[model samples]
Target: MKRKAPSNPVTQTQKQLSLEDDKVKALFNQKIWDPKFQDELKDEIANAKPYNWGTIHDLVDDDLLRAVRKEIETEIHFTKKETDIYKVNQSGDLANLSGLDWNDLSRLPNMYKLRQILYSEKYRDFFGYVTGAGKLSASKTDMSVNTYTKGCHLLTHDDVIGSRRISFILYLPDPDRKWKSHYGGGLRLFPSIKENIPYTDPCAKLVPQFNQIAFFKVQPGFSFHDVEEVRVDKHRLSIQGWYHIPQKGEDGYIPGEEEAWIDQNISTLAQLESRTLQDFEFPNAEREILPFHQTKHYERLLTGEEDNNKDCKFLSEALKLTEREIQYLSQYISPEHLTAEGITKLQKSFEDNSSLQIESFLNDPKSDLLKKLIKHDELNKECPMEAKDVKAPWKTATPSHKWRYLYMDGKSHEYFATEEDMLENLNNEEPSNFKWLKETLINAKTSNNDNELEIALVDLAQFLKSLIFKKYIATLTLLCPLAEKVIIRRFRPGKDFTLATKCNLSEVLKGVEGFVDAVLEATLCLTPSNGWTSGEVGGYELYMADETIDEEEKDDTQYERDVEDATVYRRDDAGDSVLINKPASWNSLNLVLRDESVMEFVKYISWGAESSRWDVRIQWDVKSMESDV
Candidate 1:
């Protein structure tokens, strides 16, 4: 039997472009290069929230699909996995299941027609012309077709498979009774964190209707979503593909481009709470990373809330939603506070901190729990920086990675995950300015030397970690921001501890002349938020009397000598101040003097300095906090 034809779903209002049309080039120029129009579209995109949710019924006509399948059937390979199962008709220049080199559909007529139609001058004019922007890639032509059968499903996963800016699914179901939402084959959409990152939940969904088209931008994590299970006994036919940059007539195309594109949109490693390095790197590489829900709709359901009502609008008079609720809607609400009081507290919190208003009807004593939560937050810091984070997400090291460390041989070092990425960049082709960085940094330092060293770090990642911890503390410090509230609690090596306690703010920072002196004595720089430290990754170090780390250490000296040798230095040769250096040491710490190297290839070194050390007063003890208020 022959496949049914895809009805002409193209509307008169919708502009159509033919591959053979000359208007193609004109459309490309006017849409992407038009300065004024481009600017406007950019602004719109910037303000647009994360988005995705689409389906197309007439993507391929019957004659087209049948003819195309016949031509490429020998070329298709179906790889099915538990979570998702699909038959691949065509991939880019990558290898197929045959373990052999394959020709791109450059010679196929129907395939060529597909490409021309997608990138046609008229199509560019109508779509690109409106979007006012397009990705210029070395190899952008990528298309794939798949078939979903009984019990076969593709779970939630942001279609962030490649350098995909947009995702479209052209369905070819039997032209009969509606491709009802119950038939099980429907498209889902998700809201993104900020248009780039996929979230853990889906905010939208859609079942395919014959001759219909659905499309959306590719939001990574925030746009997490998945297809619904096929509930009926029927096969769903769809041509799912992406709009890639023009490969034009060129040779070299990197296969990892898709993965790299996705990586580029992800947050810093620190934000992700990922690895410190690699498998052999710090923090155990064996430690599990964040769960990959891929698509958010299902995972969010697991959290109890089945849906965001997809398209259901809030009834303003029935139960008005405050502005804060709207804002929080964009954020991932921590599941711990899911009670009625929690909801009220969250609503009230918006009222207090934001211009959000809560309807009188929703207020109840049940909100007391959230109020207590806020109070608790006001009383103490909630999130502390665990030493384990040195190997946690964003900072966790991968395997044998050390490209970043070899790029620099500077002094006191603090390593973060971003720095490690430099090592994985060795495959860079064409002209690159960072190529020499890896080699240059490796030569810059001889760990055994006593020269002024520079620490090559992923400053952003370090800064984010510091920010998270600080913000949490600030949330708790609703009590007050004190500059130097020195709690002189003694830690008898393995016995005592210093904890955050109620202390007077004015008393700590008020005209205290010795505070600065003492802090400078203990560390080098501070972050300077209400006198609290902020970005002090490569923390302050007090070199030795030799103005170098090599200064002789009298670790077992009598109390008198210990005090004398533990002095902080402010001159040419400084010694270790607070912490001690490990033996493997910053000596072999690697770095990239330039930004051209693959960061993951280097081993990061930490600045561990030690003097004739003697424990002193505990000062910097901070953490993150959250409150319903």
Candidate 2:
């Protein structure tokens, strides 16, 4: 008994692993730990511009990695998940690596060994030294394997989830083939506008290669990144993980610091979300109230006293209605909003805050007809999922991550997917505006566009373009001084939405300045049915206060422009929203006075929607007289 002695379990396990797998011997390049290499790598990372990041090629043992990949491909089950921000296939969190039965270990032997090596104290020290992230917890290993195939993507986000100190991804694409940038699924890093608000485009990109590792310290607001949509038919497999701060009882553990970091990180999201809504969404509450002085000014206009004294023609001039025009308008507009008292109430609301919602906007007869047509088109017409197949005067909105819909802009005669095609179409047209609707409809009515496939939808678009409809819009918004851009939009179930975005001062309309601070926008929703009352199926219109900071604030050197900086307004109610969440409704008109910072969007229509969210969207770059008068 004394001769055998007690077998050392840990030593026996290591011996068994060494005997079974020679591939594990080359898991990490030993040169990474050499004194000279470590010093150089630290310097390179510390001095890196834009952001601190590093990449290593041939980071893993080839045979072992290939075996892990094979095991994943064959044994792992993936679920496809989609959101407004991302669409990707993901496997369950690799919890099995931590606790495996004998049979499971036998099957996933390579994966088990890989996990052991990655979390080992030796590798932890190396990673900690290189990233300068301090002590990483061996106990808290968070990792998941993902396969991004065609059309898979992830929109911009900073990986600042709780306790995450460093973020890394190890690529396992085809070892024999080169993964090119054109094939698309590259990791893109975005530059910040101030802090937390990332620019629309990426400033840096990393096209991953097989057996390569990419990593960076997880900075809350600064580490914005995304995976570009996979354009070609191929698989991009990778293991994504985070190294967290050491927990209590672990080496280098600091008391109360992790909690403080998590609290600060969570607060960043809360602060940004509020500011984001205000800067980009609609119906800004901060400026929603009509000042008493503006109300008095508006009252003078309504009472006809201001017009007599100052030659200020308000609704009368805005409407520009002759007897013939009134007759045509009467066909579409309900009598409720046509009266003097009704006009006064609307004027007061509009003058006060520049926003109004008129229920029963259209006359009963017209509403009934329009609703029937929309329902019939939705039920009968074949909706194209691909942007190219969409017909025009309707064109499919491209770069689906931002917005996707069949929109009748009344400019393009055919579908245009690329920005170049859209710009060309705009330039070729006589007027670079949606006022082209009238002309487009006239042409469509007279000549048969042989390529046009969906006739019913075209007819519906023609209705939205009719002079009668425009007159009704003019009566409500009083935005007739400026040229209008009208669009009939159809957000198909499951595939359509507009991401939150603010209205910009269009370069085309820069010369038409001296207007109001806010842009006038309106939407007439006609969903045909009552199913959208709850907003459960999406298609709700959302608006929030503007989040833009003062120009001087940005220039302030002392202002901390990081996620931790709570420079803007901070409240417990940061994420609380003020919205005009009218789900798809028949004959409901929503008009908004939107500043450039006010964000707005039609939420994505879920597959569960009863039908499409049909709307006649309108915009005007109006100059508010109140600004000067």
Candidate 3:
């Protein structure tokens, strides 16, 4: 059943005013770039546990935001995802959506301006700087505006789509006071204990204030941010945007610079990441067959009107072979004769053994889906996973992959592999990462009639996912229905451990737990062969009383010696030795491990923050004053 959106996200002038008042006057004049705010930003960024979310208080320009909002209300068309409502305006897809000719920008002036502004070099530079992305290509930007309504809030998601280097949102609320806390429509930032799994409680909140912006690097696991429910009657006005690889010579980006960047960042587990692959569509309209189409073609074109077995493409081909070899050809090549072992997974197609109908497109394996994938493989093109791909990418799919595809469309999820499995695979590298296991299972899947195929597929997914986490004692993965690269991580105890690769952690963790007496061996990858040049360096000492005072460097601003049992450590590279009261916090961490794999996995774990926000959060307060009633 199609779901209904919970609430509207469109913010009006009147309601937006209610979100803020003169009471938060301090917050209004709050410096967007002040040091104190920076600390809070850092704290929110570091302590950002998974599932917690954050939104920009002022991520983008207010005038442009208002312009976009006007366009969305006046000219844009919207649709539904179960119950959620969305309005999209992509430059390239404008023709399709508006059914207008794309010859001139003057025709759609506002959309043209939006496209121009988003792709402007100025915007690109600002985006790249804020994201610490260096220089970005203007052509990569696919800017759009999204309007949400009752139940319109997007569920837990990572905006790490294909080739999107960074993702951001610019909130447009009232010109007056702030967007208050109680009305609910606040943006939340989550911290990661591990990928995919989010912790409760927000790392930071934007109380629906006007003209604010929030942004983060599209770190799949860590950048797990979300929109709050629009509790009352209101709509949120926001501009969604991305920064892409510099186009050609736009930023002096060489042809392979983007790929090289990805290669330098990705993890092996990402290599096995599932992606938005095309589904299958019946090709009854075509005369030719498909590439994966194992069915044999007729010797000479059968032009006659009344041919028997016209229902089956394989039978028609067999009719031309003469009667002597008809039965033999039918045994292997005909759909009827495709003993559950043929190219197509007939068993999955006929689970009930009642209705048996193969998609006609398989008759033309050279159909759109296969052909497009082949072209992509050849060009090494990283197709945009933007929702816009739906306009052109899914038309030629067949019934088999289509069945799987539909599940993705409706559910936006798929089961995939994890980093921990890959870490284990790296440890067991004689066989090269479940290659044989996956092949055997796929082979078993050929006989779809066997229920074991589903189980085998699941096993294959898990095996592929494990390659993501190298340090975790355990790890888990969840692919968005059709989106394969955006895998979420769920670390299982002992299966995985994440050292902040973004931050130099060699300075910390010494005395905390493992490093009290001697040096600690952390599992973070730092091999020259693995792209990281910084080698392993760690040390720690148990929490102890300060005995010797460095009179030369006696600074009053040092940490208070509140407790004597805190662990302290000087890391070889990960910064200074600070006392840590909580060692268990280091025991488990949330971040994707990097590798030379799918690049998506690399992005999934990469760090994206204005500054680090580190903290040891205690969810439940210990009531030392009162006992259990």
The best candidate by lDDT is: 2
Per residue, candidate 1 scores C-alpha lDDT tens digits across 409-515 of 11112333332342333232122112233334346657552122111222211221232222222222221112211111101111111111111122233352211
Report every candidate's CA lDDT: 0.31, 0.63, 0.32
Candidate of highest TM-score: 2
Task: Please give the lDDT score at residue 441 for candidate 2.
Answer: 53
Candidate 1 lDDT at 347 equals: 44
Alpha carbon deviation, residue 548, candidate 1 (Å): 42
lDDT of 3 by residue, 1-629 (tens): 32332121223532333322222222233353455664565456544444322344544345555655566566655543221111111223332211223343344455555455444555455445444555876544344545544333432334544445666565655555555665555656655434443333346665655566566666643465556555444566556566666656566577887666555443211211222111111111111111211222211112212232344454323323344443333321233323324423432333332112232211132123323433333245332222223221121111111110101111111111222232233223221123344444456554433324223223323422231210011101110011011111111110111211111122222222211111111111111112111111111111212232353553311211110001011111112222221121111222222121101101111111111111110000000100100
Give per-candidate clash totals.
Answer: 98, 14, 117
* Candidates' RMSD to native: 29.3, 12.9, 27.3
Better of 1 and 2 by lDDT: 2
Model 1, which residues run further than 4 Å from truth? 1-19, 22-79, 83-109, 130-139, 192-201, 209-212, 245-263, 267-629
Query: How much RMSD separates candidate 3 from the native structure?
Result: 27.3
Preferred candidate (TM-score higher): 2 or 3? 2
**TM-score for each predicted model, relative to the true structure:** 0.32, 0.53, 0.34
Tens-place lDDT per residue, model 2, 486-586, is 56778887567765556654444445444455667779887776677765566778776555445444432112211111112211102444445556787
